[model samples]
Target: MSQSLMVAFDVPDKKAALKLAEELGGGQGKTAKVGMELYYKEGAAVVQDLQEQGFAIFLDLKLFDIPNTVQKAMLQLARLGVDFVTVHAMGGKKMLQAAKRGLEQGALESGLPAPKLLAVTELTSISEAILKDEQNCRLNLKEQVEQLALLAKAAGCDGVVCSALEVADLHQVVGDDFFYLVPGIRMANDQVGDQVRVATPAKAKAWGASAIVVGRPINQSTDVKTAYQAYLADWQGSEQEK
Candidate 1:
């Protein structure tokens, strides 16, 4: 897929989520992210609903568990036929490997292509201070993210969910073949909210991000389509400028 924008469905229920999706043209080659909130409330039926509406789903459960348990969980997720899924890179190499294996096996059985397994590096919510103080880690924030990304790639993941702030360095370290799906995107004038590390869609594109996940800036707007189009414009850049 070309560099893309994935609208995050961060609402409380399926009705709200679907409404937002419909306002954005009911998918039709677009992608939607069903994160913890919506997924936990509505379950797999919502994913199927989105698929039927022609939305490619990114099921961001961020699974983290022992290798066997994670593998079992991934097996079930693979059967959903989502375009992407996430697991915590902090889960270690064994768990990441097991998760990939489960997806492969489950997709084969379901006669579907396995979702791209994206390992979550450090959350955009985590600041450098939090990394040193709360996580009690030796590595600095960038170093830690880079380390986890290497671990994920070694374990057979197709990509990683990371901050756009780290994309340039990660591209250097992890290479272009690995997908860098960034989240925590905010426009220049947008509020930072809970995310500490954030960037505009234009910066993300310039830094070579494979894709971006956007939420409140579009979702909370009074005019959702206009907000989405603005983001897409920044992300894709103007043809005249290009």
Candidate 2:
């Protein structure tokens, strides 16, 4: 796990998020994502309670609406004090700009730290065929990533959400500090589930990932705490060896 290895709690409700957070301590105890499922159930109060308990939130709405709509929605999400949020790079420049502006304005108004705005280049589930046939993106994987990485940077996003596989190439195109929030990470021996281009923590770091997202390999293990601690030990060991 990287510094931003926010374990996705893809659980069904806020109660589940809180329970899972409690069960898994450390940052897992302090940070978790609230995607569509839980967000719809508990709303901002869930965010408040978690933050009140010293947790950091990543409001995983992946907002992709029109400029005005995304802006308004981001403003509200910011007011809730979520640590991070994302918008689709495909949402167009105006929408991305609006989203960034909305977060900035919300921070200004509420006297709260603004959430980092990440541009989702593509979902981890997407494949080469989908890139070519469905999205009509002409570039191959590397080219497409570079293109989107540039787009995210130019649109004022703090970073791009990519798979660990794209990190090195994207870093080359965008530079070291442009955050890459990678998902679709599988441990060296873990099941891949639905993610196509996953990599291990060492590989992800070698590829220049700023952080990564890990789900079942840690969360769904028979011994969740031990599994997560193994990941921590492995990743930290690798970092220290460097």
Error of 1 at 191 (Å): 0.7
lDDT of 2: 0.79
* C-alpha lDDT of all candidate models, in order: 0.92, 0.79
- Model number with the top lDDT: 1
Which residue pairs in model 1 clash with each other?
none
lDDT per residue, candidate 2, 1-242, as tens digits? 33455777777776777676766764434357667777788778777766766667888888999999999988887888788899988898999999999999898899999999999997888889989999898888777877887988999999999988788888777988798888887777788888898888767777887777778787677777677666655555545311
Off by over 4 Å in 2: 1-3, 26-30, 238-242
Ten-residue region with minimum lDDT total, candidate 2: 233-242
Any runs in candidate 1 off by more than 4 Å, and if so which? 1-3, 239-242
Count clashes in each candidate, considering only residues at least 3 apart in sequence or on different chains: 0, 0
